[model samples]
Structure formats: C-alpha cells, structure tokens
Target: MAGGGGITPIESGIIEYAIFIVLLPMLAFPIILFLGHIFNGNQTWVKSA
Candidate 1:
C-alpha cells in the first residue's frame, strides 16, 4: 500500500488487517457467551433428581 510521502510494506498492511480479523472473534466470543447465558434463563440440560 502507498501512503503519503512513503510506501507501506504489503506484509505490514496484511498483518494489520489480519489482527482485526483475528481479534474481533477473540473479543466477541466471550461477550456472546455471557450474553447467551443471561438470555438462556439459566437453564441446564441435565435433569435434576
């Protein structure tokens, strides 16, 4: 990629976008999991005797 007054390395650009692509799921997973539990009404699968 080209920048003002300089050239940006292609590898660096790819890695920068890759960081967001990889990071988004990593950050969202925990948030989604917690939200699911809260919305799930605290139910468990196993039947209690």
Candidate 2:
C-alpha cells in the first residue's frame, strides 16, 4: 500500500474527497455569480470589478 502495490479504499476515498474539495470552489464561484446577477441585476458586485 505505502509502496504503491494496489489501490486501497482509503486511498480512493482520499482522492474522491480531494477532487470534490478542488471542484467545490470552482463550482461555487460561478453559481454565486449567477445568483448575484439574477438577484441584483442593477447593483451587481461583479460590475464594479
């Protein structure tokens, strides 16, 4: 396991968690921007930037 013999369940779970952790921020930013635009069409925070 430590020397890369076979894939362990714990190792797979860690990879899954790592993928989710990396993706969440990427997903959240777009969703938040869309929601903010929808809710505040005229006063969008993104417009100032």
* 1-49: candidate 1 lDDT, tens digit per residue: 7558654698678877987888899999999999888767544754546
User: Worst ten-residue run, lDDT, model 2?
Assistant: 40-49
Reference-based lDDT, residue 1, model 1: 70
In order, candidate lDDTs are 0.78, 0.83
What value does the lDDT take at residue 48 in candidate 1? 48
Task: Give the number of the best model, judged by lDDT.
Answer: 2
Which residue runs does candidate 1 get wrong by more than 4 Å?
1-12, 42-49
Instruction: List, residue by residue over 9-40, the lDDT tens digit for candidate 2.
Output: 99999987898888999999999999877878
Best by TM-score: 2
Q: How close is every model to the real structure, measured as TM-score?
A: 0.50, 0.53
